[model samples]
Target: LPATVTIDQPAVLTASAAGDDVTCYNAANGTITVSSPTGGSGEFEFRINGGTWQEGLVFSNLAPDTYTIDIRDKNNPLCIVTLPETVTIDQPAVLSASAAGDDVTCFNAANGKITVSSPTGGSGEYEFRINGGTWQEGLVFSNLAPDTYTIDIRDKNTPACIVTLPGTVTIDQPAVLSASAAGDDVTCYNAANGKITVSSPTGGSGEYEFRINGGT
Candidate 1:
């Protein structure tokens, strides 16, 4: 008769995720690549979010959320490893815009201005545009024409989060001025007191003033 003996060893595994913690709008996709297992000889298997085990060393097309990566040795089911890693996804930014300045004022005067309120979201500066024009810093729009305009706001860190708003500005011309004098140029100086009358100025309201020799 021959004697038989059995020996067993535990399995060990380690893995590292590729890329940063948060997936920005223009950043690369999140992924996890597992290294070869140690202390055992068996095929490697992986599973994400507690899903079915897959035959591969790398996982792709992952979203922003907490994930559970399970690694096990097919030869020895008891020898397994589990890792919990969180994948973060940035949220879209919210932007608000407002219009200011005179709407109905004197002609050739500065038109209404458009301003953008502070936005909430990722860090970095913000860009603005008016009437589908070029993008620029600051949220102010000056010397705008008296017409409707389109406003746009976007984050410098990410281009995916852009906000659009509709706006309008109006301007009016100043009133015209005209005056006439009702009196004869040649009047008998010493003959019966000469009479002179002044007509009210045109396009003027509130109060009227008559003066001679630039005096009030």
Candidate 2:
């Protein structure tokens, strides 16, 4: 029986004929169906990594590594072979943004800034935008008003895809003064008399003070 096997990636193996002069090669992860030449009683032995030969079908779960296999016929002791090969597996490309996580909360503030970083060690240019506005490289924003903003980050290498991050900003009004200070510490000017009157209230200090433009 003669059979051909297909494997994943690249690897090597050896096949030899035993009694019935049956040979096999390239028995990879693919299918390996054997057929007797005369359709008569024939048996073959298959071994991997120089281990004991198994009298059955062999399937390979090829990982990101290499392997070796040997096949022989049991009926013929003169049939023996050895094969060596190498396999290669490439890594997948990945791009990600580290700026936004699960949630983004903000307090009372007029302006805000957010920074975006790349985790994959690939060094390349990047662009960032808010609410689908103009894109800016380096993923840096400044003087952003208080509101909910949708951010988009894109890698220059792969412009077709973009990463998005949502953020929020808030602003609060300033506090105001309510009541006046104690008098005569507080005085009023009388334009008719061309004079200022300072009246000291009861249980208050008698000290007199004057100021122009809120200055002494």
Off by over 4 Å in 1: 1-4, 18-45, 50-61, 72-81, 84-104, 107-110, 165-216
- Model 2 compared with the native: what TM-score? 0.34
Q: Looking at model 1, how many pairs of residues clash?
A: 0
- Give all candidate RMSDs, comma-separated: 6.4, 15.9
TM-score of each: 0.57, 0.34
Task: Give the count of colliding residue pairs in each prediction.
Answer: 0, 9
lDDT of 2 at 61: 37
